[model samples]
Target: MRLTDFTELMRNEFGTMASDSMLRDHVLSDLGNRTGAVAIEEGVDPREVWLALCRDFDVPRDRWYLHPS
Candidate 1:
């Protein structure tokens, strides 16, 4: 997914402040122990980062994809 899409998903799922904190602070072991921001900075796909976040935090499988509008 595009960075914009990833960013929007993060905000939509976690709210702005918490999403920002997670991107900065939550170390995603699946992404080599890098925070979401760092993984993205190192060229990881935003989609992978998003899924890692979901798995790490136990976000429901149904919510992994964006909702239909």
Candidate 2:
């Protein structure tokens, strides 16, 4: 799938403020599932997915560890 479509799916699935740790866990938990089911579906490394999320949301990588709920 296209990056834009993948990004939108990430946003929709995770919500606006999905925590980085949560994202990490989500990806890990679903690692065996179809690639399209995870955020980095297009062979993007999980770290890259987290970095992209941090960049897009303007959240510092360090701050992403804090629990949002």
Candidate 3:
């Protein structure tokens, strides 16, 4: 999904607190780790990142671009 969509999902899932930069990073790290996407190299795929976050956070699968395992 697009960055905008990801941000919106964050807001929807976490409310206004999601916009906090530090909290955002914490969330990313938590989700990234769960999907083994922690490397986060330059060539990392956005779809994979989105999938990781969605799966890790239990964000309704229907709202995600990729239904992560």
Candidate 4:
């Protein structure tokens, strides 16, 4: 998926508190190795690997720590 799509997905899934830096760090720290492996094995973009993760995890695109009142 595109970066915009991924960004939107992350915003929804992890909430507004989850900044892009946080997401990048989390992905690198948690899924970097596995994602790299999968990307290499599947010949897909690393970004796609991350997208698959969000999709597989059923992460919402609008997850919020606190719903607006």
User: Whole-model lDDT for model 2 versus the true structure?
Assistant: 0.48
Model 4 clash pairs? 12-60, 12-61, 12-62, 12-63, 13-60, 15-63
After superposing candidate 1, which stretches have Cα over 4 Å from the reference?
66-69
Stronger candidate by lDDT (1 vs 4): 1
**Candidate closer to the true structure by TM-score (higher is better), 1 or 2:** 1
Q: Candidate 4 versus the native: TM-score?
A: 0.40
User: Candidate 3: where are CA atoms >4 Å away?
Assistant: 1-24, 27-41, 66-69
Q: Give per-residue CA lDDT, model 2, range 1-69, as digits (tens).
A: 345544454565467565434554443323443232254645755445544555555665564442221
**Which candidate would rank higher by lDDT, 1 or 2?**
1
Off by over 4 Å in 2: 1-39, 64-69
TM-score of each: 0.92, 0.34, 0.45, 0.40
Counting clashing residue pairs in each candidate, in order, gives 0, 0, 0, 6
| Deviation of model 1 at 47, angstroms | 0.3
lDDT by residue for model 4 (3-65), tens: 455556556665666545444434333444444344435555535555555555555645422
- Candidates' C-alpha lDDT: 0.92, 0.48, 0.51, 0.48
User: TM-score: which candidate is best?
Assistant: 1
* RMSD (Å) of each candidate, 1 decimal: 2.8, 11.5, 5.4, 8.8
Give the per-residue Cα lDDT of candidate 3 at 15: 75
Expressed as tens digits, the lDDT of each residue in 1-69 for candidate 3 is 454555565566657565334233544553434322232343445465655666666778777644232
